[model samples]
Target chain A: MSKIIVQGVAQGTVLKTTSPINFLGAVDKKTGVIHDKKYDIFEKSVKDTVLVFPHGIGSSVGAYTIYSLKSNQSAPVAMICQKADLTVASGCALANIPMIVVSNEEFNSIQDGNQITIDTKSEKIFN
Target chain B: MELTSEENAALNGEHGDTLQTAYRILVATGEATNAEKLIPIKWAHLSGVNYNTIGDAGEQFLRELSKDARVKVKATVNPMGIDFDHISEFNHIDDEFIKKQASIRDSYIRMGVEPTFSCTPYDIFDLPEKNTQVSFAESNAAIFANSLGGLKTNKESAFSALASAITGKSPYSDLRKDDITTPMTIRMKMDNPNELDFGMLGFFAGKVGDTSVNISGVSQPNRRSCKALCGGMGTSGTCAKFQFIDSEDEKSEKVDFGKEEMNEVFDELNTAEKGDIITLGSPQLGLEELSDLSKMLKGKSFEKRCLIFCSRAVQEQARTLDYINEIERAGGEILSDCCTCLTPLIDTNETDAVTTNSIKGAYYLNNSTGVNVNLKPLTKIIEDETK
Candidate 1:
């Protein structure tokens, strides 16, 4: 089951990366490019897509990096994580980005390029 | 999460854009953390002041927020990129860096935040009552406030602390809750350990524990060692509070930290055989540390360049006590409102490595500043480096 951590409506194609994201190092704030070659989604753009990752791993400064992305018009439409840590939760709140938490099974089931819709009121994810 | 009528009004945009934004952040954080409601806080110590850390996006955000928002509670900030007073003394800081740094500070000041850029606000500012709730973003200060100051706070992020400052409210969860249970214990097997040893033990405990940990071994540590332990633990992991294991709580799950484990951590952080310069004060030294340093370096001078970081408040007190003259006589340059971690003052072209007692300093200097570290204790540094 996927729970809504931050309530909102977002529908878009998923950009799933199995590796956890550190907003400070893993993504570019200006271009929204996933430049961390260690991850599977290298060279991918997070703009306008539903970004999915395991969780955030980095300094608290990563929260500002997320807000910077939103200000620069390079932010994701929504975020899906297996767990919502303080860093990501605060960043999503600051940027007004919708955040959803899903089970490990559901996270693995959602593949890159998969299309989906999120509605926090009904607490459902439709594919 | 259930919010009070005032909180609801703030979220409903009845208050203003600033409060609406602040409440939105609070409610979202509360919902995420399973907090029941919002609780008022006495203070908020924020981070993200360093331009090198926050970048252009953060600067722009602050500039916009400063226009309409003022802190609802007492607020203080973390260190910026450079010591604004000593800009001409360092080679690494340029005009662009200074301009950006000034803008960040200005934004905070315009929002009614105090320009106390020290990370150790507990040393400089008048602390709130014991058990009173606050929000702190600096990791070391958060650890110290919870463990030593008897205050309640979660390890808040920069944005979360800023939100709390604007709203004077924090989510009632984590360390703020009164129902916190006794945590796992890490027993240190060393007898008569110094500050560096305590630092190693703290780093080990923070790595192993979750939210809180119990440490047993060192008893009645002075202020300097306590600060070192807090700095080391803050650098290692997310562990917030450390407690001494009470004699009645011997049945808890216990881990051991001995010489072997200490050497392992030392080997991990100590990457250099020697340092080009000696640096101190990762958490920024207080009056106590300054007095000790002064006594150690009474007539002797450093053989190489030595940079000491401290807060202007403590530095003034140390000057009144004649500690600053002794330090300066020993060829130590005292920089205020900044510390060794992530400061642009230490240019890689000027020096390759730093020798310090702080585990936090060693970690960041090596990882972020592209330098090596010789992790020696204060006693060892004074013995070998001073003549």
Candidate 2:
């Protein structure tokens, strides 16, 4: 019922990630390795901040990576995108994670490592 | 946002069962792009190899879907793979790729999709005529169809593309190709120029341009660079609809789209720094390409670590020759079937950094693998080996 503050809400279990295709969002659903190799959003770049960005950037194989993490039960609890491309969409669907897409500006408004919450049904984002 | 008559009818059970399945898929894409109505489609290129791999679950699902619905187009070719001992054009392929390749191929065949087995599907068949609406997959091929051939296709999924082809229409929206007027202008440049360096330049150009670029100023480049740029840009900006312009052609239609103008149009979403993993052969390779690499890599050793990958379809041939032996011997591992853009076959933590000559390879590696990738020329890779 509230919007997660860009800098303040960069915490809480990361239910959603908006990382662009370049800066990969990490969700080790298996061992719960929330740290990603793509750019260390949780570990270095944002340091476990609420992660947000555009849709995934790299391979459709991003689908498999998502699957691996999700199957291992280490994936983020939810996800939202400016647009849900195949890689993340497939993974979200397969893993049964809540995913939605909003405007790019709204995506940018989010800061790293902020505690975040999401309303998947309403497509409203909270930080 | 409202559904078109076709989409509305499908949702309301006006269309047949097949149309309904197609409708579900189209509606998902339509909602994403914020399209108002759906239009019928004539052809498509599929994405997603299978609903399930290693088992008949996918085959059964597709077989059931095929029973109720049929594609609308004259021909629909899914992304390519191999079932047997065929061409081996990829690089650094791993073991047991053939089994996975065959599993997916079996699923596609069961779902009634033709196994064209080439990333460049236009080579085998003519694209739907200019402005002929079709569903397509993969960013690079979509760009090639839109800009190079003038055929119209939105970056769609295997399901949506399949739905459009079956229903013979797609949802007409503001995002439709016909809706786009002129391509956006750019002013990007590569720091230095050399042979085989075109790949990296194209990649960066695509990234810089973001969706919908009319770029110029890629001087003295080649065909691979053009494709690489288109492909890489597609990766960076999923909705990128672009045309690499003829920079030197004063009378040409190609416009400028590059790094200089990137700040104007795009919001730098997430950034990467210098030097990372070196990847090759993202979208499956053919046998000849892999064979050539095997020859080039003969007796070569890497001073730095690199990940060499090949598509599973082409890897079959390489495996026959035991190509990985050369890579393992040369201090690198050959990944099969999987491309770096999707996910690292191995974990990213095991490696320090990366570098490569492929723009597509670099973009995926940089973004998906979390490795800062430096795209270099094949010649440079060779030089490093000799050193």
Candidate 3:
């Protein structure tokens, strides 16, 4: 299979999902705690890493979370989105978290454990 | 632009005493967001910032600029006070938090702000009709103004929106509908989830869409539920932030809902199966809600195997009220903003299925974490559990 990658470059700590908590309120910049109390899934701190979500969901403050993460030096190096959003764009621009977007179909080909890379110059993503 | 020379002068800080600070704050905010000129808004809704946050440079700026003007008072709806409840069985009570909202509200009042103290302004506030310029803080409310009532506004911070409200004009940038409403693709089933689920789904969709939406696959919503979806949509995607709902059948009681809100919840209910974990409080919890939860668990203990949810902010507050400790004492875990961004909660070899009321929680867990999700209504869950 031609694993066509949507490559882009970003600076962030590569984070993997271990539990299910909404990404929106998942990470808090002020405290650097990932609050997802109900499920024993995952609750770890994320800072200065590449945080990629197969997709986006959460409060608009999710953008502010990125800003708070960055301003407090608690944010990822960059973010990769299956789709781009107003909050993410504004936050990325405001927080300077380099971002790369890929298509859903393209993302499906990339596995969880696979090491994927993005290059901002060409706005391309690859594994 | 409606400012007379005197109003402009006041905006420029010609006003005396308190009005001076308000004026300068507005000017700086307008510049930051790229407002060409200031316009006088008919109303303003603020988030009633914390006393500590008000001490920042933004606060000083507001004080210096809002001199002589009276601020032409209006109503406001800020976030709930830090601690307003004295007693709750779901958790303990914190008497100390009582003054938190007071301090924040007092400072805003001193600087000329009204504190309606709610997340949903369309519920109570006298919002101007389509194209009527308005200014409001609270992320959820900002999208509500644009997507629900057709009024115009941009997302202003604690101070910026207040400034715009006082000035009666927003930056005039993306607040316009033509600039905000864009189309996007979203694949999610929403069925009769409760109001909380409605809001969560909107958040997830926003995250997935990553901008404002012109989407397919959902339908019909109650007005309030639509606002919840709009609020969530504003979080990740659109400048305006919205979703259109689809419905096959609804009673007269259901007509108030928007197509987007109904479609999502109905889809979830129809599809969700048993044995899923339900989580709540993704955007954080309210002080009053904390009190309610304390009562919910006064005598009963959580089914150790079930899943629950809450925000990091609420966790901190709970600690103060002993709610967190109590929840722990009762048999549940309280975590800070933990998940997706951190180490790995999903990809790890963990549980089988997760259930939640927060639409954002369900969407992210299923999409990002690869977890099976069960979403339900908060009210129904409470009724079932309590009964």
What is the TM-score of each predicted model, taking all chains together? 0.89, 0.64, 0.51
What is the Cα-based lDDT of residue B201 in candidate 2? 39
Instruction: Give the Cα error of residue B175 in candidate 1, in Å.
Output: 0.9
lDDT of 2 by residue, B141-246 (tens): 6767776767777766445565666677665643354657544455445455443334433444455444456655556444445555556555555544655556
Best by DockQ: 1
Q: How much is the lDDT of residue B348 in candidate 3?
A: 25
Worst 10 residues of 1 chain B by lDDT: B244-253
Best candidate per TM-score, number?
1
lDDT preference between candidates 2 and 3, better one: 2
Per-model lDDT: 0.85, 0.52, 0.49
Q: Per-prediction DockQ, in order?
A: 0.44, 0.14, 0.08
Binned by DockQ into CAPRI classes (incorrect, acceptable, medium, high), candidate 1 is acceptable
Q: Candidate 1, residues A51-114: lDDT per residue as tens digits?
A: 9998765455678878888888999889999877667788898888899889999998888898
lDDT (Cα, tens digit) per residue for candidate 3, span B122-234:
65545676787777665667777776777766655554555455555455545543555344544445446446656756655654443354444455665535654664555
Kindly indicate the candidate among 1 and 2 with the higher DockQ: 1
Q: iRMS values in order, in angstroms?
A: 2.4, 6.8, 9.6
TM-score, predicted candidate 2 vs. hidden true structure:
0.64
What's the CA error at residue B142 for candidate 1, in Å?
A: 1.1
